[model samples]
Target: MNEEKNKGGMMSVIAALGANVLVAISKFIGFAISGSAAMLNESIHSIVDCGNEILLLVGNKQAAAKVSDKHPFGQARAKYFYSLVVAMMLFFAGGALGVMEATEKLFHPEHNVENTWLVMGILVFGLIVETVSLRVAIKEIKALNKDGLSLYRFLRESRHSEILIIFAEDSCAVLGLLIALGGTLLSHFTNNPF
Candidate 1:
């Protein structure tokens, strides 16, 4: 049963990783075409999410390695360490980049969004993809949660680190897409990048 749960978690992570990679590429293309700082920030966020998923997969695999005499308790702690790295990347890549770009755009007041419709379409598509990924992660979490806890409680107390990471990433991706869409629209209408 535990192995099955782990497999489900791994599948969720892989699904999210695939979605993030595609979304990142699309967002980068949108940034190139529109020159929207929000689009660029979102592209960076998706790239960081891809990296986080890869790290989680690696940590999960390492944590599952066979125990040896040199290490009696196994390497389960590796997942925690990698989770820490993911948090740091989120701070630097997602949070810091968004802040820096927003600041620059605010000060510069340059709006170069040529194809607003294309940028909006790409952001909407990204939202759909991220929603699907989030659903997959939530389904996996439901399968693992035998305690019948509330979703929030389960998220807060669950021991499944991979699922938690996937859920958080997908949620943030969706929110970031929405923010990007709003910023794109605002910039298109106001003629300012802020």
Candidate 2:
């Protein structure tokens, strides 16, 4: 793989990885202090995002391997394999855990969040970090898209999975943070953490 050609993808992945790591640590701390299930879910989500970014980086490295006699076309599909694995991780690790937690919360109806301020603070920080990462991914994607297509079209037709995955993960993180913020505020006001 040509570094010059893939610089944007690499930068996007690095930015997302950094963002997820920070967000995950902060969220875990917040969850520990507040006991917010939402915070826990966000922490898991960030960890999954971090893991996905690392897997994608590995995919990049694998794809960069020299063509061998056994495989003449090179390992370009390594990215796709890693992308599939990332998808499974997101679905099983992130989505399934969130769903299970939410269901348990529904049944238990406990005041999980003891410290609203800290949880809210963590959520806001996560939002900011994820948004910045998302912006980086978008900028890199836009640079790669030379056809002047609409954002939706570009996203749909994009071939670069690194930037695409970063964009998606960051977008989900921002949305999750927003939802968590709203839920936290509601719980604080209503005295209901369920």
The top-ranked prediction according to lDDT is 1
Off by over 4 Å in 1: 31-41, 189-194
**In model 1, which range of ten residues has the least summed lDDT?**
1-10
Give the 10-residue window scoring lowest on summed lDDT in candidate 2: 1-10
Q: What is the TM-score of each candidate against the true structure?
A: 0.87, 0.88
Clashing pairs in 2: none
Candidate 2 residues 3-115, lDDT tens each? 64445487899999999899999989988877767678668777877889999999988887889998799887797799789878877877778788788878987655577
The CA lDDT at 163 in model 1 is 83
Total clashing pairs in model 2 = 0
